[model samples]
Target: MTVFVDTSAFLAYLDRSDENHETAVATWTQLLHNRELLVCTNYILIESSALIQNRLGMAAIRDFQELFIPLLRIEWIDESVHQTGVAAWLAANRRRLSLVDVTSFETMRRLFINTAFAFDQHFVEQGFSCLK
Candidate 1:
């Protein structure tokens, strides 16, 4: 199964200062050991990298990418996905959620990936199993 690596999880993994670092690290280790397939979109990677740089530092973000990017099956979705994501955002709870979040949801729905490795409650609200 290919787990959708959400920004929340990516942040948790990269920022050791995070409150969820322990849990995220444990889960990450387990997943890696189990050889669980992983996936993400360029949408997620861009946001995640920026957040990592802002919250932690540019050095950390660079290091994280060196270790993480090759591990993911990046879904470079197109303009169609962006259009669908925009619609999903409007239909979702509010415009508070970003295109990355909405697109992650839409992409998951389209790919039939029911499990999302996310700390965001929106995933659960959207009827997907959030891997804590």
Candidate 2:
């Protein structure tokens, strides 16, 4: 199975101090053992990398580039994806979702991926099963 990876899960997996770190690690290990295909959008990578660089420092970003970048297949966000995300973002009123979250949702829908490696409740609310 292919699972869409979100920034929250990535951050938790990389940072030991995160609240969901243990769960993310265990889930990641299980996915790896099961040979599940991991996928992420370019927007996700950008957000994750920026968050890691700003909060965790350049070394953390470097580690992410070296250790995590090669494990997953990247789906580059094109004009269509951006437009879809913008539409979703504008349509959402009750939910305070970020552009990245909407973009991820669009990417997942486009790829027919229902499961997400995420720690965000937004994914759950969007009817996507978040795997901690």
Candidate 3:
């Protein structure tokens, strides 16, 4: 199965202090053991890298890059995906909802991916099943 990895899950897995760290680690291990195909959009990579660098320092970012990044099959966002995500974000009209998240939803829909390895409730709210 292909699981969409989100920024929240990346943060949780990388930061030991994060509240969801333990669960994220366990889920990550299981996914890897099962050889599940992990995927993420370029948007998630950018968001995760920035957050990891800001909160955990360069070492953590290196770990994310060297250790975890290789396991992912990145889905690069294009003009069409960006435009659709922006449209979804506007239609949602929720301030707390992010454009990256709406784009993730669109990406998942386009890929026919039903599950996500994410800590964000927005994934579930958007009708996607979350691993954690």
Candidate 4:
């Protein structure tokens, strides 16, 4: 089964100080052992990249660029997907949910992916199975 990766999970995995770091690392290790097909949208990538760059500095960003990113299948969000996500976000009118999150939801739905390797509550609220 394909698993969608969220920014929260990426951040936790990269930052040792994060509260979820240990759990994320264990989950990641299990996924690696199982050879799960991980996937994520470009939106998620941008969010994670920016966060890592800001919090962990350029070295972390380089690690993401060279190591982590290549491990997953990227679901590039196109115009239609963007529009759909925008519509969903607007319709939901939830202050907590960002456009990127909605885009990830749309991407997951489009790809028929139901599981997420994430620490984000939004994914669980959206009915996607979250690993942690």
Candidate 5:
């Protein structure tokens, strides 16, 4: 089973101060060891880079890339995905979900994915099972 990894998981993995860091590391270790499938979207990739650079510095980001790059199967986000994200945002009744969340959801749906290594409650509320 492949999982759509979210930016939150990446942040946790990079930030030792985060309460969820261990969970993220443990989950990623399992994925990297061929115990499970791992997937990421362009949105998460870009977000992770920015976050890592800001919080942990470029050196740490490079370390993260070295560790995660070979194990992850990255999927690109496209124009149609943006349209779908906008539609989801506009149709929502009360939830204040962001385009990132919508993009993740759209990509997951398109890829026939049902789970994510996410700490975002929005993902779980929308029916995707989270790692924690």
Candidate 6:
């Protein structure tokens, strides 16, 4: 099975203080043990890296890059995906909804991925099944 990795999951897994940390760790371990295909957009990488660095410090960013990143099949967003994401973001018109989240939704739809390893309710609101 292919599971889309989101920034929420990354943060949760990396930050021990995060409320979702335990669940994230358990789910992540299961996914790795099952050898599930883990996927993510390049947008997620950028977002995660920045958050990790800001909240957890540079060492966490290193761990994110050297350890966690290798497990993901990154889907790089092009101009078309970016535009589509922007349109979705505008259409949603929700203040808290981010362009990255919309792009993730688009990426999942394009890849036919139904499951997401995420803590974000936006995924559930958008009708995608979230692992955590």
Give each model's whole-structure lDDT.
Answer: 0.87, 0.92, 0.95, 0.93, 0.85, 0.95
Ranked by lDDT, the better of candidates 1 and 6 is 6
What is the C-alpha lDDT profile of model 3 across 43-123, one tens digit per residue? 999999999999999999999999999989999999999999999899989999999999999999999999999989999
Q: Please report the candidate that would top lDDT against the real structure.
A: 6
lDDT of 1 by residue, 15-111 (tens): 7788888888888888899899898899998998888888889888777789888889999979999999988787775756888988998899889
Model 6 scores a TM of 0.98
Tell me the lDDT of model 4 at 93: 97
Tens-place lDDT digits, model 5, residues 21-118: 99888988776676677888878888889889999999888987898767788888889998888888878845668777888898898998999998
Clashing pairs in 6: none
Off by over 4 Å in 5: 93-96
Model 1's alpha-carbon lDDT is 0.87
For each candidate, C-alpha RMSD in Å?
1.2, 1.2, 0.6, 0.8, 1.8, 0.6
Worst 10 residues of 4 by lDDT: 62-71
Where model 1 places Cα greater than 4 Å from the true spot, the runs are: none
Residue 85 accuracy (lDDT) in model 3: 94
Candidate 6, 12-121: lDDT as tens digits: 99999999999999999999999999999999999999899999999999999898998889999999999999999999899999999999999999999999999999
TM-score of each: 0.94, 0.95, 0.98, 0.97, 0.89, 0.98
Error of 6 at 108 (Å): 0.2
For residue 45, model 6's alpha carbon misses the true position, in angstroms, by: 0.4
Q: Report lDDT (Cα) of residue 26, candidate 2.
A: 98
Q: Residue 59 CA error for candidate 2 (Å)?
A: 1.5
